[model samples]
Target: MLEIKNKLYNSKERKMQKLFNKYMGIKKFFRLKSEKIFPLNENEKILYTDKYDYKEKNEKNKSDKYLSFNKRIHILSVIPKNKIENFYYSFCNFVKKNPSKNEFSKIILDERLKKSILNYSNSLNLGGWSNLGYTTPKSKELENIVDYFHLFIFNLSEDYIGLDFTAILNKDFNHKLNEFMISEIKNEPNYCKYYVGNKRFISKTGLNKDIIRREKLDDILLEIKMRCYDFLNLYFDLFPLNNKAPITFDEYITNYEFNSKNDYLLRCYDFYIFEDKQISRDMDIIINHNDKEFSQTFLDLYLC
Candidate 1:
């Protein structure tokens, strides 16, 4: 965890040397094994994460349930060892404004947030107005990842084939992924925006007005996304995919109700990120960010 928070992308040698500094002394060996999930920083492109203050206490990542490594970071393969220390700092800082949640429940920068932070004028039009993702994944992977750009991840070891994740590192994402996945795993249909839930297109199932629990809903979305990609051969009708239609991230979470044909939707993908205000009335959804990492809380019902 400390390695991730302060990992240097100077080079693989520097990364390994730094990692070795805390090499578990027998006592921590097994516990440390889990941390060795991905490839060694061959070229160490570690995104600098220290600049921005995290929600946890004194920069203690463990204090933040979402930041916990064992829970999040599901599909990390070998993200290039980047020399972009400022990248991490820049990412974390941007997350301070437009934050996101990892599978472990930690707050991190949205993958697409990088563009906005880099301030490439008119960049919002870049990357399809989605969040952030640096290491785009191979088509075969996205099976278990939450979002390729951020760290939210998942693992269905019991009832699945291979690991799945959002790949933000794949150099050629759209084209290559299309080739590999063909009909198996592909982007949202031409007219769909994913709303998190069963076929009803609502955020909850078999319940009425019980949408306060955003975190649990997030977990449910993971299950749905996995099934949507692996099990369903692109369930287009069930999601909101049209380019003209703006996908509602948590339609049910709002005071406004939804109808199946309204074309309004809810989804976990368009996470609500805020700046200045930290504590939000997440209601039942998980809340992240600190005073500086966060400030006040406000809910703005989005209509694209």
Candidate 2:
């Protein structure tokens, strides 16, 4: 009888010990990755690189005018892997079918450049705040209140792959439009036909700092990803722009790319491809006067 009683008590003690250890494990995890609340600053702050660094920043935020969120939230907008792959495959097929007209397609067809494009698409970083502008939660009602609302701004031209003036379609089309528009307008040299990357997207989210410090921050980031994804989808579907009649290729390209900071040089092929188009056919024709090698290379690529 005594042996049976002893066994019962021993089992109960072991179970209690396991429960205590579980609780302590979670407590320690929170202590390791806690966040701080701080005021906004104009200067840049280094982003968190590791678990230890995040914990250290939490302590630093305890000082005046400095508060840190449990973790930074950044989500890439949905450009699905399958879709990107399909785009590449379709592009390759198009190049094979339309080889003559698409002399510039070789840039995208290069195996090394294509690999780089795939890798960049897989790890694209699309959305996040430069620095958060935080305000105290409006109400004392803890149920409704949050730590802060953060705003993220994105510039399409510099942040994406296969955009800007890199694509042959954009380069050729923009050049043709800019030339015609410039001749018609007086003192307007900066106008262009179409912009390669002049779009921006801004997003916002509210987070519960208390839950984040006591728990894992990955949950908050997951929620942020969903919200950001919706915003991006809507923005892409209904891009807001003022509708206007078409202008010459030079004027069109000039309007968007003049100060866009994209690196591209005007080539003879780019000029020749759009020369026969009706909108730009009236513009004074200019041949590539310099770089005989480049001109010859362009001719060879198109077999012109």
Candidate 3:
């Protein structure tokens, strides 16, 4: 049954749904197949690489801000080889259940939503008041209130495979409307290049700051900004203000290659590190962008 809001958003909702459904359906089918092909006796393990860094501004910098050394601990989750099928379906369901484009766009930019998601992710060192355009010393209650809402698009990975942006896809998928939409994600002018990693279903649970330390969660915070950049990239692909030819994702990437400090840059994990034993409960570390030595050190302890 269509609700009143559904009626209002029907055109866009249907359009987005149609384009994405095929991708979702196909992905769902394969994920289910992966079950028998790759059996699993337990919940999956997720591996991811994300860095977080911040600067304490001094002299010679143009803007008044600096990147923090606090890292994001870029986490990826998997449910188990046996659960891939179920995980993908859950992810697709979330996409279909996603709020209308208008709703998502508006909520994402809202300061209230920002505080809710950020604080829920972690409370320490959220920077000064007004840093996120809100009054300082926000109450946890205010943050939890929006827990009932969806603040962004998420993909829940199942099993041991680390499904991430690095997954393989076409050289460029602008031809596919869903890919086109994804291409619109805003990215910094100089963030690292992203190639098609793989096709996988994904979803998100709210961030658990307790599980991830403030020093590490900071990197996760930055990854959130990178995703915001991803959205802009797709949006620009669909709508361009320039009279001349609109740029491609590659072009946008090229433009920002060296100018990430500008607002146009996508924020990402750049600083901080954490030992694996501190966080892993049966969780294992697989891929990490941090130095191999550091990763190995963590891995060694995790094994011990």
Candidate 2 backbone overlaps, count? 29
Candidate 3's C-alpha runs over 4 A off are: 1-75, 99-159, 165-304
Q: What are the per-residue Cα lDDT tens digits for candidate 1 across 1-304?
A: 0011111123476555435434422323444355458532321212111122222211211222221011222222111122123434643553453333333534545555444434432222223222243332223334333234343212223221111233222234322322331123211101111355654221111111112233333443333333323321221112232322121122122222222222222232223443333433322122334656543332322222
Ranking by TM-score: 2, 3, 1
Candidate 2 lDDT at 190 equals 14
Candidate numbers sorted by lDDT from highest down: 1, 2, 3
lDDT, residue 89, model 3: 44
- Per-residue lDDT of 122 in model 3: 28
Question: How high is each candidate's TM-score?
Answer: 0.17, 0.21, 0.20
State which candidate, 1 or 2, has the greater TM-score.
2
Q: Give the TM-score of candidate 1.
A: 0.17
lDDT of 3 at 11: 56
